[model samples]
Target chain A: MKMKCTISYDGHLFNGYQVQPGKRTVQAELEKALAILHKSEDKVPVISSGRTDSGVHAAGQVIHFDTPLSIPAERWPYALNALLPGDIAVKTAEHADDGFHARFSAIKKEYRYFVYTEKHPDVFKRHYAYHFSYRLNVQKMREASEHLIGTHDFTSFCSANTEVRDKVRTIYELDWTDTDDGLQMRIVGSGFLYNMVRIIAGTLLDVGTGKFSADDVKGMLDAKDREAAGRTAPGHGLYLWHVYYDN
Target chain B: MKMKCTISYDGHLFNGYQVQPGKRTVQAELEKALAILHKSEDKVPVISSGRTDSGVHAAGQVIHFDTPLSIPAERWPYALNALLPGDIAVKTAEHADDGFHARFSAIKKEYRYFVYTEKHPDVFKRHYAYHFSYRLNVQKMREASEHLIGTHDFTSFCSANTEVRDKVRTIYELDWTDTDDGLQMRIVGSGFLYNMVRIIAGTLLDVGTGKFSADDVKGMLDAKDREAAGRTAPGHGLYLWHVYYDN
Candidate 1:
């Protein structure tokens, strides 16, 4: 049976979500927990809604793992959390239809990037946020984000190593808000390529810093080349906020 | 010449305040920053008020580094912070009397340990605090802290490997308070042996959990055996809050 789970994890310790032989990854951790719980040496395959890079955190990372245990779905979260480390926690768990796949079934994904621009670095939130010394123009960044909405070729913002042939993807919404903590950039999209969100964040940061304008983003989108965009932002600031799947 | 400086550090990235070969430490980083500013590799020797374990944090950690840069003492914090990494910052710097030393001139040291006594863990504060799932009796902990006040032989609460023969120490204050964030334990002492604060925290935690009585602390103190005390608390939750040096 397919068991779907909503997980929250501190990605700073892992290379990424993907399982590697020697590295400590989130998937590997989950599989280890499952193996221990089920008393089986065979590894259980778990699928995530998205692949997050190293240092990228998640509050609503969705995943699914198939298990032979006939345990009730509601008990999964408490059971999993009991075995997982303090860094990872399962907020909710439920059984899904056999056809449900965490990644391919997702209709939309929302991501948020946090930046701390305060003069004094936060003693508590140093790891969970990105500290930028210079002030940023939220209005300018919002203006640039408009050019990012809608279906278009995101090649300029995508990682060069992305194997996806079609560079086109739909961005349903783009929002920016500044709070007491820092500037928050929230982007919702139907799909995102490798390093796509971070590059877009970097480009928007360029606009916020007055180095570029909204038109520059449009120009880069038209160019459809990775070199046309700004540098990729640090992964630590970005988070996989939510995932939407059509029933 | 003694240059008295107030230093601030994240402390998560460092092994401790002391300098050790092949390890990145707070004192080592400060010395490196001074070396760059002074244009010589081994010119500055850094000394700190106390040594904090790896994963421990500090805000008003005092240190002194001698330099011949001729920079005004008041401007030293600004000068050194610019040269240091994001994790470490110099809060204040001042010239001191010839015999003034950060470690030797210290009269009292204050430390704080943050505990999150919740059913689940806080993702952002995972590294910043110790998460105790069981309920902690704050009143009980505070009541027990009263027993720890004043001068006493704290041999039971000292680390087993401590080299200091003198087990007698004066605890100026010991208290616990409940905050919106979590529980905080504050301790001030004239001087502490190795792992003394952590051991005290551990013993107090046992009192909080109803495992030990407030009056039991006196017997433990009188026993002078390490086995009479509670388990040693993890180092990550401890923070060297500040050090007082008699001017």
Candidate 2:
């Protein structure tokens, strides 16, 4: 039987989500804990919905693995959490349908980024929020987001080194709200390419700072070139907020 | 001229606020940064409002130092912050009156403590908030705080090893509010004894958990013995919120 788990991890503790040689990664840690629970020398492979880059956090990341052990669903979180490090936690665990796949079965994903707009760095939020002192016109950024709300080819908003050839993706929602200390941008989409969220966050800053007008977003979308958009925002400010699967 | 500076720091990086022989400390960092700004071989001493133990955060900690440089008041924050480490920051700096002292002249001080009530630990807030899963009765805690208000000898709330002979202190206000995540207690007083706020927080938990009643607080005060009170809450949960001075 396949088991599904919802996990939350602080990105600062790990190198990234994937397994890397001689580096501490979230996947390696999870598997090592699972191996101990399973009482097996051979590690149980855990599959994640997606990989987050170094310094990118995830609160609602989904993962799945096949297990022979029949631990109750309610007790799985307690069992796994005991072995997991302080930076990672298993929030929920339950049996998944045989058809369910952690990544392939996901219908939508949400990504959120935090930008601290204050001129002075906030001591408490230095690790979680990206300190961006640049002047931002939120109205202009909102206007620019309106143009990219629907299905579009987001080649210009993803990294040039993205492994995926197809860049067409549906962005269901793109919203930004002014928080007390900074700005929070939440984007929901069918799927994302490599560095897609970070690039979009960076490109929106150009429109917000008056370098590129809201109208230029349409032109950049048409160009389908990586250079047409702005710089890629840092990974430290990005969080994989949620993943949705059809009921 | 004597310059006053309001500083903020994440106490996780410091051993304590005071300058120790070789351990990293908030005062040591501040003075080291100031020594570079003064361009002198001798360390420019930085005096703070009071010493906070290791892992106690401070957002409005005031410091004072006599400086020979003629930097503008507006430029002091930038000048000092540039030289300080990431964990410590100078929020504001201005020329203080001849008699103003960071510790001696302060009229009142506010200390805030955060308690996370969730059964599971929060990954992001681990450094800032104390994780307490014990059942808490906010109303009972509030009633207990009423007895602590006004002039009283807080000998029972302070550590027994405290060097100060006099333990009498006046609490202007003791307020606890239920936040979304947990409970936040803010205590304002003329001054605090060593570990006073933390011990009060711990003792209030006894009241909140039914180990003691609201009326017992007065008896604890009358006892004037540290053993009469409950345990000390962890230092990481406490924050020196602000200092009130006569304008």
lDDT of 2 by residue, B93-191 (tens): 889998998999999999999998876667787889988888899999999999999999889999988799889999999989997878999999999
TM-score of each: 0.79, 0.97
Give all candidate RMSDs, comma-separated. 4.3, 1.3
Can you give the lDDT of residue A173 in candidate 2? 98
- Score each candidate by Cα lDDT: 0.86, 0.92
Candidate 1: clashing pairs of residues: none
Candidate 2: misplaced stretches above 4 Å?
none
Candidate 1, residues A1-247, lDDT tens digits: the string is 8899988898888888888789988888988898889888788878999778988999899999888899897788778888988778887889899999999899999999988886655555556777776778888888889999999999999999978999899999998889988888899999899999999988898888888998899999999999999979898888999999997
> RMSD in angstroms, candidate 2?
1.3
For candidate 2, list the clashing residue pairs, or say none: none
- Please give the clash total of every predicted structure, in order: 0, 0
